[model samples]
Target: MSEKTGTFLVTHADEGSAVFRDVSDGQVHTMASNPDVAEQDVLEATIRPQPPMEVAWEVVEVAERREIELVDTDLSPTTQAMEIAAEQEVGDVERVERAGEGEVHVLSVPPETTEDAAADVLDDEGTIERAARLGAVRVEVRREEDDGVLNVRYLPD
Candidate 1:
């Protein structure tokens, strides 16, 4: 598969509609105009300006397990994270290391047979119950890895 993956940019303003000249060869797309949207909805963004403005983006991408990198991932490896989360029998996430600018929350997941526990943890809605639910039979509940080390579960099926 191509190293390039599709991205879903969700922002008040369609900031990704345009890109810098150097990076514009790819990774650029047209924006859909929305008139119903209030000025505040799209503050001073790449698209439009608001009365008082501030803009930001939330980009998302989906990739297969083989396409994922262990340490450099934007999100946790749900498969592994969940397995680790479930095994510890605890629910508390702590930042293990800084991933890019965002930190990595080494959540513990049950040792069930879910494909990607780590990814689930990273995509979590910041709710333990929700994260846990994603874990097939096992939940991606964050637990401690002894001392102050926060990790995922390690329970066996």
Candidate 2:
């Protein structure tokens, strides 16, 4: 068979190989992949049929890759909002105060924001960038019941 180009959704990936499903044909193909490839990643690749089965395929080159990251909602509503805001644009975040070593608390979020809505704005690229710069990998959202004060704490992984 000849070479084909299509987008593949990675169903499984490990140090040795990866399994991807063609977005166009719903066909699953396993190929030798870089260990960095991960599940749930969408990859655009050049493929060729393998052996006797036309359904079997191998990747020639990866043209593109995309991944959707899910954010945890264990934090308080306001902190979640600020976390998303920070991810969207760290420059837009203000009143970031240091809580401890590798820890920071953000105090600028309004009291009325909902957690689910805030979680929607989170993306891996921004989160990773912010985490690397701040030297932390965990975020905690806290709210004071009496005064209605909201604080976002960034902590180590």
Candidate 3:
């Protein structure tokens, strides 16, 4: 009987149903019917628990919905990001905010594990969640071939 309104990230979508994770609180809501939203979409909506079990939720109204684009580029990390990576040990991740908006995340990893690390970041739901929280529209992943440093930039456009 209660409704919640906030930004949500679509984590899963199939033929008939979809799963959304609340951007603010990380609560998982399973919708009985797909709301025409796809995975990785950020939605601003009001939702109420379904009848009977109330274990599921339904989207009563959608104020806004957008897909956050992901781009993987061959570009190298920024000079500042490289400097931060140089100062940190392997397996360290540093988050730096942009002057205008969004954030740049610098990750230091072993050269042998660089590819795996980048792949992991690209595949993580947390990445999209962070972008949604920051109101970013796109995520760019940059890394040098065989390098130990990677950069994930959340950008608004």
Candidate 4:
């Protein structure tokens, strides 16, 4: 989908949505905006056109949005690793910390845990799948395949 940004002049509100006039060309558009918007208040929003999930083309995310701004900041590598590791770790993940290059996360599980056992545990917990879908961190549950050892390597995203 593509994004469209504009100023909205609210005209009416109903059922958690709003009818607004796009100030750019005086065209009327209905979107899900703030219900409390005054009749003439102008609102900045980011809208994406969704191609007919069940109906015709529609716009969404019209409540509150602002122009994009870029900022510069430096965050600790360990902190970043920990956050991603935590998000991906299931109940068996005993420890998560930053490691050296090539593999950024070091995870410690129970002494008795094997790679297959860890994989089974993670499967039951379902957090690893979620982490994979989120794509926030790259990780592996085993260090060496032949050794049958369970470990986690965080691949930075």
Candidate 3, residues 137-157: lDDT per residue as tens digits? Answer: 999988854669999999997
Which pairs clash in the backbone of model 2? none
Select the stronger candidate by TM-score from 2 and 4. Answer: 2
Could you say which candidate leads in TM-score? 3
| 1-157 per-residue lDDT for model 4 (tens digits) | 4666766555566666666655556656665444455443445665554456422223454565222111111222244444554455443343443454333333434335545554563443233332322232444544333322344443444
Q: Which is better, 1 or 3, measured by TM-score?
A: 3
- lDDT of candidate 2 over 113-138, digit per residue (tens): 53432443343334433433454545
Write candidate 1's Cα lDDT for 60-90 as tens digits.
2223111111221233454544454455543
Give the lowest summed-lDDT range of ten residues in model 3.
Answer: 141-150
Whole-model lDDT for model 2 versus the true structure? 0.55
Could you tell me every candidate's TM-score relative to the true structure? 0.27, 0.40, 0.91, 0.30
Model 2, stretches more than 4 Å misplaced?
32-36, 51-56, 71-157
- Give residue 100's lDDT in candidate 3 (0 to 100): 99
Tell me the deviation in Å of residue 139 in model 4: 57
- Write down the lDDT of every candidate, Cα atoms only: 0.30, 0.55, 0.89, 0.44
The predicted structure with the larger lDDT, 1 or 4, is 4
Q: List the residue pairs that clash in candidate 4.
A: 138-155
Report how far residue 7 has shifted in candidate 1, in Å.
14
Q: Candidate 3 has which clashing residue pairs, if any?
A: none
